[model samples]
Target: MLENWKDKYIVFFDGECGVCNFWVQWVLERDKNDRFMFASLQSDFGQKFLNERGLESKVFNTLYLWKPGQYYYTKSRAVLQIANVLGGVYRLSAVGKLLPAFLSDQVYDLVSRNRMKLANQKCFLPDLEQKKKFIEV
Candidate 1:
């Protein structure tokens, strides 16, 4: 099914972060249009993405949303973009755009800094269809 990922949005996440995994699960459950695919920041695909963009690969502090050969969004911007892509009620996330990127990223940084302490949530198991959405997991 990896072949099906062409032209889909890619979400890059911290493989070891429980919070990140939880959100990945959240996105997977809500991706009604099948518009997203995922890869852990530690994977070869992810490393190449990061290296090509001159981003740090060793530290998985930021989330990234990428449209292959197009552009990528990071931090709170990524979250907002994800919400926007999800559409429907999630479009409510549009209000978040009113806040400046600096402010939004500050919030993102706070959560990122303490993500390990904050997320007690366990990532639910993915069904086979959902499982294929991951790239080199």
Candidate 2:
């Protein structure tokens, strides 16, 4: 799906999950420069992206970041890379990179496993002013 993506970062997330959707909204709200494009794991574009990357479609356990021809990151690393792209205070999240990947991923796995339990089903509706930053594709 992303063979033609030339952007610095493409965020792949779980669209149906309230928590995931909320985070996407939060990122868009804070990202004043429109630095990311989103694709749900269930979307055709996302499926094609995973296929092209050789990742299993069934594993929606982590956010996926496709940074053009450079590299890809998952779980905690993905979140951190996204923060770095968003800049400002979000750049602080990059400190997570200091920890061991195994430990960082364990924390990410826990939050992902329990995100549904933490949030209600209502999806956040962004105001018109903030809606332009999000791409549902």
Candidate 3:
């Protein structure tokens, strides 16, 4: 099912992180164009991508957005790119680019460090349709 992902954006996140799961659900609800797909960093598919890129495979604190055959964005860059892809009102997030990436990423890291405290993990069961967006491979 993911073979044609060359044209789709794949989001690799921490499946066990409540904060990360919340954001994934947020994006899914607003994804009017169905341009995104997801995988947990603990999943084989997410680990393969990280290993291929020489990224930290044991840490699940970072988020990655990959556009196959193009490029992948991580941390704050991935967040902004995701917002941009959401389009319409979300395009306003482009303003974040005014700040240097290092500065933006610092904030991202800070949040990542405290993400677990931000929200408690809950049993979130996605509807059948939403389940289809996740790539177990």
Candidate 4:
């Protein structure tokens, strides 16, 4: 069922994290081009992706953006690509690319380490149309 989204960018995130959900909602709202889909890292499909890539399947701290049969991005790179794809004002996010990858990843790691405490978990109910953009719950 999930394979249908292979042509689009898939955003894999921690289902239990509120901050992650917030960002997912943010992207959903800004995704005027319908270029992205989403799945929780805890889902079977997400685990398959992680396991196939030799990544830590159980740990969902890192954000991932996958372009099937092409390449995938994690951490800061994923965030930037997502913004770039969303376009419009988000295109400004391209400036982040000017920074060294190591430096940007450090910021991503710091946020990841404290993400749980940064926001409280809540049920995010999207409208029917927005809901369709999610896969595997």
Candidate 5:
């Protein structure tokens, strides 16, 4: 699973946040191209990623999209890139690119801060195939 992840886009998110988990499921549902892998921000692999990149490991509000040896995007950039990678109508997300990153991030932060209240803890049971997409779960 680890080796296979090297070729896919890795989405790192706040594992305990219902909203975060919801978004992960959203991506899973739309990923017809099998382009995404996921890791909870609390996982060891996620911690290592944060440490190596000099990011705060404990602050899980920030979402990270990593493409192994290629590149990584965070905050609004990550969200936009995920939509781009998902392709099709989601490509319209390009319009979001027009907003300044700072502005977009402010919106991300707002939602992140209130994410706990936005949704109750939701349990999503992934089927066998979907289970394989998780790293260090």
Candidate 6:
């Protein structure tokens, strides 16, 4: 299974969160190379991937990145890594990685915990072309 993802990066996120869904869409839109694939943490494939990585399955509140055979990253680290891959202005976000992990994660957690409330209940739907980029389970 890991070999199958050698050419792709996976982003596992909370499907029901308006903010998370929007971010996924935003990433897809800017991902001209189609280097990323997405899956909701609630999906069976997402759960299996987390379990295989020995990561807590309930940590879906923040973003997750699965870079095939490499180690997985979560929270702010995951977001920054994704941005770095996207290049350009997005790569600038990688500078935040210089901050202490605990402090950065605290901020990430705070925003994630409140994202749903802040974004309301808007459902994120990508366009037909973008839908092909999703690795739905």
lDDT of each: 0.93, 0.79, 0.92, 0.91, 0.93, 0.83
Better of 3 and 6 by lDDT: 3
lDDT of model 4, residue 108: 97
Between prediction 3 and prediction 4, which has the larger TM-score?
3
lDDT of 3 by residue, 57-94 (tens): 99899999998887899999999999999999999999
lDDT of 1 by residue, 30-124 (tens): 99999999999999999999999999989999999999878899999999999999999998998999999999999999999999999986766
Residue range 1-137, candidate 4, lDDT tens digits: 45569789999999899999999998998888889999999998899999999999877899999988989999999999999998888889999999988999999999999998987787788898987888884
Model 6: lDDT to the true structure? 0.83
- TM-score rank order: 5, 3, 1, 4, 6, 2
Clashing pairs in 6: none
- Residue 119, candidate 5: Cα error in Å is 1.5
Clash count for candidate 1 is 0
Per lDDT, what order, best first? 1, 5, 3, 4, 6, 2
Give lDDT: candidate 6, residue 81.
Answer: 91
Residue 60 Cα positional deviation in candidate 6, in Å, after optimal superposition: 2.7
Instruction: Output the lDDT of residue 76, model 5.
Output: 91
User: What CA RMSD would you report for each candidate?
Assistant: 1.2, 2.9, 1.0, 1.4, 1.0, 2.3
lDDT of 6 by residue, 1-137 (tens): 33344578899998888889888988998999878988888888888887886777886686898788788888988988999999988888877989988999999999998997887677777888777666665
**Displacement of the residue 92 alpha carbon in candidate 5, Å:** 0.2
* Model 5 spans > 4 angstroms off: none
- TM-score, candidate 6, is 0.90
Off by over 4 Å in 2: 1-5, 126-137
